[model samples]
Target chain A: MKHSTNRLFSLGAIVAAALMAGCVPPSAIKPVDNLSQIDNGKVIVVGKIELTPELEPDEQVLGSSYEEYRNLALVITDTELRQPADQLGIGALTRRINAPLGDNFFVSHEAQPFFILRSWLVMNAEIKVVSPNYVHVPGNAPLLGMFGIDVQPDDRAIYIGTIRYHRDTFFGTEKVEVIDNYQQAKNEFASKFGEQVQLRKSLAMPVMNN
Target chain B: MKGWVKKTHCFNGLTLLAVALLAGCAFSGGGRSIDDPTSSLVFGYMDMEEAPTSMDYVKLQQVAPRSEAGYWDMGTDDGIMYNQYVPPGSFKVAHFGGSSFLMGEHRYSFPTYGRNATAVTIEVPGIYFIGAYAYQEVDTGFFEADKFSIEPTENPSEKELLNTLLTMDWVEGTQWESRIKNRLAELQ
Candidate 1:
C-alpha cells in the first residue's frame, strides 16, 4: 500500500511539472524592453508573415542536435545525444511559443484597428528566420529572427517588411526586407484577410465557441 | 391565530406602501420627457455589421439649441448580433439636431451632424428612434486604406427598436414598457 502511495505521489509531481512547462507567458517569445517604440495612438495591422525559403526545412532548423534530445529531460547520460534535450525540434518549439503571441497581439480586445490575416492563411505566409543573440542553444549557431514593424502614421499601414537579427559574430547587426513590396503585400492581405475588418466596421458579439 | 393574521395583514400593507413610494420617487426625476421640460425622450438602435475588436457605437450630438454628444454602447439581442435602447434624453435638443464622432482626427476637415445640418428632432412626451450606421470601405484611395463613414439609418423599424429595448436595462422609465409588451403580443 505504501509503495503504491509513493508511486501515485511521483506521478502527480510529474504531471504538475509537465503542465507548468507549457504555461510559458506570451512575453517570453518577444522582447518587451523597448515596447515604447510602438506608438499607442497608431494602429498596427499585421500584414502577411512570411518565413524565408532557406529556413523552411525542419532538419536545417532543428539541426542534428534534435535527433538525440527527444524531450525536455533534465538528465542526459547517453553519448549519442547530438543536441541538448530542451533544444530538440526548434521549429516546433518556435511555432508553439510565438504563434499564439502573434495571434493575441493582433486579434485580442486591446488591439483595436489591428487585424491579422486569417489563421489558416497566416500559416501559409512565409516567416523569415534569423540568427539571434537572445536564444542560446549548446554548440549550435544562433538561428532566430525578430520582426521590427514600422507603422506609417499618414497611411496607417506597415512601412515595409524588415526582419532584423543579430549577426553571427559577437558585434554588429543585419536587416533584410521581405521580397514583396509594401503595396503588393497589403493588396495580398486585403484580398485574403477580408478588407472590411476595421474598427469602424459593423459591431457584433462573437459567437461563443462552446 | 387572529393575532398572527392581523400581523401578516399589517406587514403586507407596509410592503405595498413602500413599493408605491419607491416607484414614484424612481421616476419622479427627469426620467420622463414630460417631467423635464428642458429635454425630450430620444432612443435609438445602433449597429455595426462587422464587429470591431473592442468598441462599436455611433457618436450622436446635439450641437444646435443645446450642445450634447456622447457614444452609446449597443447591446446584443441575437446571436453574434447587437441592438440597444439608448437611455432617454440622450438626444436632448430644443429643436432638431445631429451628432457625429471624429471619423479621422488627422484629417483637416471633420464632419458633424448638427450646426447648419438638420438635426434629429426630439418631441416632448414622445419617443423618437434614430438609427445610426457606420461602416468601413476598403481601398477608397490608397492601397489597403479603409474609409470609415457614419450615416443615419433609412426606414427605422419600430419593431426592431422594440427588440433592442428587450435587451436594454430597465432604467425606471425608458418609456417603452407597454410598447414592448404590445409588440411581443403581436409577434406571438
Candidate 2:
C-alpha cells in the first residue's frame, strides 16, 4: 500500500509541472516579417486570395466591362500569419475595379465604390502556385508581386506585378478588356490548392467539424 | 456505561487522526491544496466583447488584467473603456503563475480566447462541462486550446474583472462549469 501511494504522488507532481508550461504568452504577427520570408531568391509559394463583386446589368459605366468581378482584393501575408511582418504585408495589399458609384461595396470591410462584380459563379474559389513574373506587364512584376511592395534578396527582381487592373474578384463588365485581364489574373492567382481550400480566414463558425 | 463511552471517544479520536493525515499528505517540495471550500483557490478567463449597449458594459471591464498591458496585477479596463487607444494585443494571455499559498480572485485574458476585444467572463470554482471546446481535468490537462495558464489570485480586482467577460453558458452543469473547477484546482 505504501509503495502504490508513493507512486501516485510522484505522478501527480509531474502532471502539475506540465500544466504550468503554457502560461507564457504568444507574440503578435507583422507584415515585414512575412515579406522577408518571400525574399528567398527562389520562387516563394504564396497563396493569392482574390475577392470579386457580383454586379447586375447596366450600360454606359465608363470603365465598366461586361458583367464580371471587380474591386479585386489581394492578400499577400505569410502562409500562417505568425509574424509581425505578416501584418505589414497585408497592409500593402490592393484591389482593382470599375464601379457605377451608387451601391457601396467592401474589401476586407473597407468601403469600395469602384466596381460591383455581380454575383454569378459560386463565390467559392480554387488556388494555385505560380511563377513570380506570371504576367509580362511592362510596369509591375506581375499584379500579385506588387502586394509585397519591395522585398529583399532580389532588389531588381520586381516582387509586385505593375500590370494595370488585373484583379481576380473584380466588379464590372465582361468586355474585351475584361476577358483579357481576367484570363491573365486567373492564371496569375490559380493554384492546385483546389476550389475548397481557401488561404484566407473564413471567420464564420461552423456548427460541427468533419 | 462509562467503559462504553470511553471506547466510543477513543474510536472517534483515531478516525480524526487518520482523516487529518490522509488529507494533509505533504511531500518535501509539494503541497496538497486545502479541501476546505471557504478558502479554496479559484481561477478563470475574461473578456468584454463590445456591444452597442445603452449602458456601458466597459464599466465592469476596468478591474481585470489585460494582455495588451500585462495582467491582473493591475485593475480592470472598465476605467479606460479600451475604445480610444487600446493596445494592439490587449486581450490575449500575457502572464500566468501559481502558488502554494492561498490565491485571491483575479481578472485575466486568454489562453482560451484570443482578444479582449469581445469580452466574456468565466468564474473559477465548481466543475464546468465546457461542452465540445477543449478542456482538461484538474489533474489531467488534455485540452486543445493554446497559450494557456493559471493566474494566482493575489490581484485586487480579480472577481469584478472576470464578471465582464461574456459566455454562452450562463446556467449550471455546462462544460464551462466542469472545466472551471478542474482548472481552479490545477492552479491551487
Candidate 3:
C-alpha cells in the first residue's frame, strides 16, 4: 500500500511540474532604436509588419486561483481555445486587425493640434505586408489572493518588434526602418493633443434621410 | 492482498493514459478550409462617428446558416476591436458580398436593436475589415448601413492596428469556425 501511494504522488508531481512549465510567459516588450528624422506630415508606407499571436492555446488564463494543485487542474483549461496559430495560418495576424479606432481616441482638442488623422495612416490604406512573423503573447503568472480578488483580467497591452517603411525625402524616396514600441507613440499623441470639438459636433448631428 | 494491489496499479496507469488522450483530442482540427485549403480568419473595425454613451456592448451572430454568436465590450473609433475565425460558406459568394453576420448592440435604457448588412462576403485566409455602427432613427429604432465598406489595402498602418488589438482579449482556434462551416455545408 505504501509503495503504491508513493508512485501516485510522484505522478501527480510530474503533472504539476509540466503545467507550471507551460505557464511561463513570453519575453518582455522591446522598444526600437535609432529612428531617422521623419518629415512632418509625411506618410510612411508599410513595407513589412511583424504579426505576433496575441494568445497561446493552452496558456489562455481567464481567471486566477488559489487551490491545491489538484483542484487548480480543473479550472486551468476553461479559457483555452481548441486551436492555436498552427491551424490559423496568416489569419491569426489578420483577425486581430479588425477593430475600429474610436472617434475621440486619437482626435486632438487643442486649437493648434500637434497630431492629425490622415486617411491612409489611420485607415491602414497603403503598403504591402510580407509574410507575417510570429511571437507569443505575455502570460499572466498565477497570483494567490484571498477570495476571487486574485483573478484579474489581463491588463491590455500591444507587442511589436519592428516595421519596415518607405518615405519620400527632399532628395528622393528612401526605405526606413521604424521600431514599433507597441503603439506608445500614438498613446502619447492622444494624451498630448486631446480631442477635437468640431469633430464631436459633426458626429452628434442627426443624419438627414434622402 | 498482493493481487488486489497489482490490479489497482494497472487501473491508475490506464487512468493517466486516458486523461492524456482526452487532452490531445480536445485540440484536434475538425473542418476544411475554402481557399488553398487554409482556415479562414475574419476581422475588422466598425467606424462610428459617435456612439451613444449608453451603448455598452456589440453583439455579432452568424446569419447565413443562422448560427453562432459573440459580444464584446464597447469601443471607440480610436480603438475598435473585432476578431473572429471565418467559417467556410459563412460568406462564400464572390462579388463584394456584405456582412457575413449581423451586428447589433446592447444599451442600458433599451433592449437590443440594430440592423444587418447583406453585402459583405467572407474572404477565406484573408482579413476582411469593415467599418460599421448602429444608430436610432426616430420610430425606426436602430439600423446599420446596408453597404459594408471594405478596406481595399492589404495592410493597414501597423501602429494603428496594434493600437486597436491591445484592447481585446486573446483569441485562438478553429473548432468554432469548423462547426459553423460544417453546419452551413450540410444545409447546402
Candidates' C-alpha lDDT: 0.28, 0.22, 0.24
Q: Which stretches in model 3 have alpha-carbon errors above 4 Å?
A: A1-210, B1-39, B47-49, B68-79, B91-119, B132-159, B166-188
**Candidate 3 structure quality by residue, lDDT tens digits, B23-63:** 21212112332232444434344333232222222223332
Q: Compute the interface RMSD for each candidate structure.
A: 32.0, 26.4, 24.9
Task: Evaluate candidate 3 by giving its C-alpha RMSD to the native, one decimal.
Answer: 26.7
- The residue-by-residue lDDT of candidate 1 on A72-178, one tens digit each, is 11111111212322122223232221222111122111223221111110111111232221111122222222222233334332323322222311111233233
Please report the candidate that would top TM-score against the real structure: 1
Per-residue accuracy of model 1 over B65-85 as CA lDDT, tens digit each: 321223222222321112123
Give one digit per residue, the lDDT tens place, for model 3 in A1-210.
001101122222122212233332321111211122222332111112221221123323232331112111111111112223111122222212111111112210112111110001110011112211111111112111011001112211112223322322110113323344434434443354333211111111111110
Candidate with more favorable, higher lDDT: 1 or 3: 1
Against the native chain B, what TM-score does each candidate's chain B reach? 0.42, 0.19, 0.35
By lDDT, who's the top model here?
A: 1
lDDT of 2 by residue, A126-160 (tens): 12233321211011111212222223332211112
Highest DockQ scorer: 3
| Alpha carbon deviation, residue A97, candidate 2 (Å) | 29
- For residue B56, model 2's alpha carbon misses the true position, in angstroms, by 28
Give the CAPRI rating of model 1.
Answer: incorrect
Candidate 2 off by > 4 Å: A1-185, A189-210, B1-72, B75-96, B101-109, B116-188
**Candidate with the larger DockQ of 1 and 3:** 3
The CA lDDT at B77 in model 3 is 30
